[model samples]
Target: MPAEPPVDPMTDRELRADARRNREQVLATAQRLFAAQGLGIPLDEIARRAGVGPGTVHRHFPTKQALYLAVAIDQIRRLVDEGEALAATDDPAALFTLLSRMMASGAENAAVKSALTAAEFDLRDAAPDAAAGLTHQVARLLDRARQAGVVRDDVTVDEVMAIVAGAFAAIRHAGADTSPERSAHLARIILDGLRPPSRR
Candidate 1:
């Protein structure tokens, strides 16, 4: 009998590219369905919408918590990216506008919002590498904004996360008709409080 060849693990670059495509497709479909219905939609439905099989979904996400974690992490990465992109704009209002828009859009996606909330409940620390990278990126943008006199020095990253968590709670309680405009308005109000007091 001939010996069977051992299967090899995917190369890092190939794995990353595959994961990126799968993640993007899952998020896009999940966002559309969740926005239309809510987070209560079945995982099977999400898989179907994404044109993937249930087994494939499970392979990517062993449980709802895993799926939620993936979504929350992706969202955080996106926000951090957007923040960094706007960090050098030299326009406080523009930066604020971009932040507000992101917050509003975030409020509408029930799956992503629920995932963020679940992440809070899980409270397991992020993996060291991911945590460090996200912290560095977010902190860099925040420090720049504070130095530019746009964001208040007293507003810590923890406080910003708290506000985001609260916003998700508000949306969940309010239901699908929850207005993104209202969430944006509320986020602006919260951000206003985080702004440094005017030097008299």
Candidate 2:
């Protein structure tokens, strides 16, 4: 008897394209809502906003925590994708632009910040492999910027990460009345700090 081509369980149970799309939509909507609102949002509301059925949402994410972890993982994957796209440009300025954009967007995104700061969630545990990939992509971006003579050669990835973390912390503290200009100004300052020291 044929061994049936050694059926791959993972592949066999792969989600249909529609199901995948619905899942992505759910995650994106959830991230947006969670950022604007908080993690207290109901799954039904998320499904409603995503234009999907509650069962569809539950089928993809069995619980609120599962949904949260999925959202975090998706966010990390997006950063990884953006880093790869920018790295291909080999432009230090573009890298800075990406960093600035991240800081600006991070200002409004509580869910993303929570993934990094919340001890209860432990994103590392939720998506260890994706977490490692995000770190690698970020390091690559910094290395490229350093080699381009745009960013200070002495600056380590850890230092850049620290600066980014500080920016997010500031964003968290910012009042609702805070203007967008404030975030852009802070991003510019951070970018300036990363540049090589001026010659006399």
Candidate 3:
């Protein structure tokens, strides 16, 4: 039998460096394309924008679903980090307002908005780590608010999520008249429901 070719020894550092560059390029291109043309933009455009061949893009992403998953995971990680930073605020009202604004901005991003919708389909199966991290951060913030009597003890984290999701939906569903003031007003109403009962 013919001898099999010897396998080459892989350098972990080199492999990691290459993968890092590819991932960065893909993400940057995808962000720009999605921002300009929404989530329906073609993958070929993303490859061209990245200055990478379609084959290279496929080698990294394999499919549109994979690319969307990667983008969703990245956005979720960023949101978790932002949530952690916001969690440090002492004022609950300000914290909720900041979070609401962040959610509104995220809704404006076509890729993120799509991902948020897709997230409902398989939230447990897809991006579990990102989802868990976000959930933990949100729970922490809610707990802090509850302990301080700024947020209602009866409100669950799920309820807050629903409020944000509804706000995003409303903004998208309303064509030209979707003002930030309207979003803020709706957020205030939601927050009112989350407020703790007065000690008096």
What TM-score quantifies how close candidate 3 is to the native fold? 0.77
Q: TM-score: which candidate is best? A: 2
| lDDT comparing candidate 1 with the true structure | 0.64
Q: Is candidate 2 or candidate 3 better by TM-score?
A: 2
lDDT of 1 by residue, 1-200 (tens): 99988876888899889877886898777667767786578889899989878887788888765775666656656665766676657655444554564466568665445444444443226434444544455566666777888777787866765666676555556562367666766677656766778821
Per-residue accuracy of model 2 over 1-200 as CA lDDT, tens digit each: 85668755555336476678898899989988987788789999999999999999999899998898787778767877887788788576666766775666566566555565554465667788876776677788887777778888898876776687687666546652145787777668767988888710
Q: Show where candidate 3 strays beyond 4 Å.
A: 1-12, 88-98, 176-200
Q: Which residue pairs clash within candidate 2?
A: none
In candidate 3, position 167 carries an lDDT of 59
Ranking of candidates on TM-score, top first: 2, 3, 1
Candidate 3, residue 86: how far the Cα is off, in Å:
2.9
Query: Which window of 10 residues has the lowest lDDT sum in candidate 3?
Result: 115-124
Please say which candidate is ahead in TM-score: 1 or 2. Answer: 2
Ranking the candidates on lDDT from highest down gives 2, 3, 1
Query: TM-scores across all candidates?
Result: 0.68, 0.80, 0.77
Consecutive 10-residue window with the lowest summed lDDT within model 1: 115-124
